[model samples]
Target: MIESDIKRYELLLDLLQKSKKEQDEQNNTLDQKCSSMINILILIITIQCGIYANVALLNEIASSEIAIIIKVLLIITLIGNFIALYFFIAAYYLKDFEGMTNEEDIIKYGENNTNLETIYKEISVDYKRTIEENKIELSKIDKIKLGFKIVTLTTGIFVLTIIICLEILI
Candidate 1:
């Protein structure tokens, strides 16, 4: 029975470690996605500026219906990209549980003349709470990522449509 209990505790510890590692990996992924979104936003802004410059200076399609349409599409693209950027920025702000617990804390807790079972209970409660908080954060990040992706897709389609219209007009 004692051996079985020890094995169970060991298994729990291993599972906790694995969970934390997975969360770390997920955090890294979220960070990368946010960075990529920022880059996309920059690119979109640059392209929009170029399009406006061409339309304003060249006067190729100025004072035409196509110009109006292109301007609307540009506005839509900008709004979509801005919304996606907002979500990515918000996701970036979400905190991750890194180094929330330390070995020294565990050692100090253990040295308080607590039995193994009590220590385990305390650690387990803290671990579960931390895990729950992390899960909530991850969920929020995922939702924001989903929103960002949808906006990005919509923006891409709008840009493509605008390009086709411009080509026909030019």
Candidate 2:
């Protein structure tokens, strides 16, 4: 019975470790995406704002035909970009995820000459806790990423519209 329990824990530990590895990989992927998207958003916003400012200055006359349209488009674009940026920033800045058993725990286990079964049980329990915590965090990030994606799509459309407006109407 003892050997069987130990074998079970060994299997459990292996599975939990695999799950943790997958989650870590997922977290890294999302982090990279968020970082890249933020940089691109910043660049696009900067360029768009610069264009809008220059155009507004040149078309300062109150009677100018395209001034009002340009102002409206710029306002919508800014709002969309702002919302998308919020999602990205929130996801990117989320709390750090819990990881597997730390080095100190390993050292303590070694020094205490912990039984194999005890070690497996302790490590597995720790892995389970970390996995649960990571799951919650990942779920939150997934929701935020969805929001970012939708807003980014809408914002991209608005930006393209603004470009078209600037090109043909300016």
Candidate 3:
């Protein structure tokens, strides 16, 4: 009965992983399309402002140079968003392809790979066999989560810096 329960639990976890993977894929695709559309729209707006609207704005303003500069800044803002999006999408995809991401898909697709399972089984056994095992209050699960958090946080911060620079330029 216990074995059956374990098997059932494993199946549930596998389903969860697959669901998570699908969610991640959908989110990623949405992000890419959304970002591209936003960038293109922003570019169009900047062009309009520079070629047509800015003439009227400059008429009301004291300096044409400042109007042109403002348009340039708007374009720069779009570029900044592109950079940040590129960074985020690249990281997500690379992690996904490697099956190293903390995504639920990782759990679903991970253990099914026969070779990887064998390697991980050895690693898990060795780690447990070591006297230092279980020294941390947190479970192995927590450690994996923490590692992913660290990576995500680091990349997010750098992306934020680019955003900040865009703001400052604006």
Candidate 4:
């Protein structure tokens, strides 16, 4: 019975380690998505600025209702993109994650505590603690996902605005 219990605890530890590894992979993917969204936003903002400049140069824009609407849409696009950019930057903030038990600590525990069950219990507790801490770090996933949604919606609006302005100019 004692041998089976030890084996069970070992299996539990392995499962916990696997879960932690999955969380780490997810965190890395979230970071990459955030970075890519930031780049897309920057590009969109730059293009909007160029379009605004070109539209401003048109003498008819100053006097037309359509011009006012286009300018308003452009302003909204800029503001939305900037807000999304802020979210991505916030999501990019590095989290200090708790790591697994250090080898030194394990060695120290081993020297003082000869009981196998006691050591396994302590290590399992440590692993669980780190996994919870990592879950906290992963909370930023929602913020980045929200930012991506915002960028997608705003980009669609921006495209429509550009099409309208182009039609008017031509």
Candidate 5:
């Protein structure tokens, strides 16, 4: 019975470790995507500013109606970018789950000549706690993913609108 219990604990620990590794990988991927989007946004804003400056320098202002349309488009782009940025920043601020045990700790516990039942109980508790923590982390990641999708969609719309406005001005 004790042997089977030990094996169960080991299996649980292995599964938890695998889950944590997968979560870490996903977090890194999402972080990279968010960073890439932010960079793209910056580039878009820079290009738009440059175009506006060139037009101003060349005294090529469009008709008042077109100018107003351009202004509205610019505002929409700015607001969308702002909302996206806010969500990205919120996602960045989320804390990662903690409370998982390391191999060293398990080894140390074993070396201490601890009772098998005690060790099993401790591992079981830790396993349960970690499972809960992982659930919460997964939920947060889902939210972050949703936020990133919103940002991507908003930025795309902004880019298309700006392109149309630029064509009108030209």
Candidate 6:
């Protein structure tokens, strides 16, 4: 019976590890996908701003040919923006993006799509609301964690720099 219990525990650990790996993979893919979408969105905004600026410049020039070209460029920018947005909505930001992952893994891990949805919602809202809504205790904990991270990083960098300096001096 002891041996059977040990075997069961080991099996449970293995299953948990597998689920964690799957979750990690999904998170990585989502991160990459979202970042690309964000970059495209930024680029589109920049181009639209540029087109507006060009139109203003053309108006100042009062040249009909230049004004026509500027209008054509603006139209092209609008079409390109629409196509990019369509692709962004269809490929990167699926209406049911969270539905791609398995639901069963949540029960095993004690987490579900709801938490993921909350994160997505927070992302859409610029993540500020989530930060603001968190408990004050979490901020304190975060400060402690940040201090520890800074100390550790500084110590490691100091050690490396000292070693390099000594090697160079010798």
Compose the digit string of candidate 1's lDDT tens values, residues 74-138: 67776777777777777777775535567887788768876666666566666666767777475
In model 5, state the lDDT of residue 99.
65
Candidate 5 global lDDT: 0.66
Model 4 lDDT per residue over 1-170, tens place:
39998998898888888988898888788788888888888888898888878777555554577777888888888888999999998988767788898999889886886577777778888888998877845448677878878888888888998788677667
User: For model 1, what is the alpha-carbon lDDT of residue 34?
Assistant: 78
Off-target runs (Cα >4 Å) in candidate 5 are: 54-61, 102-111, 136-170
Q: Candidate 2 regions off by >4 Å?
A: 1-3, 57-65, 136-139, 146-150, 153-170
Best-fitting candidate, measured by TM-score?
A: 4
Count backbone overlaps in model 2.
0
TM-score of each model, in listed order: 0.76, 0.80, 0.32, 0.86, 0.72, 0.36
Q: Which segments of candidate 1 are over 4 A away from where they belong? A: 61-63, 96-99, 113-115, 142-146, 165-170
Task: Kindly report which residue pairs in candidate 3 clash with one another.
Answer: none
lDDT of each: 0.69, 0.76, 0.45, 0.81, 0.66, 0.46
2 versus 5: better TM-score goes to: 2
- The prediction achieving the highest lDDT against the true structure is 4
Q: Is candidate 1 or candidate 6 better by lDDT?
A: 1
Q: What RMSD, rounded to one decimal, does every model reach?
A: 3.1, 3.1, 13.0, 2.3, 3.5, 21.0
Judged by TM-score relative to the true structure, which candidate is superior, 1 or 5?
1
Output the lDDT of residue 140, model 2: 54
lDDT digits (tens) for residues 69-150 of candidate 3: 5555545544544454444344333322222234554465556664544434443444333313212223322433443444
Higher-ranked by TM-score: 4 or 5:
4
Better of 5 and 6 by lDDT: 5
| Candidate 1 weakest ten by summed lDDT | 54-63
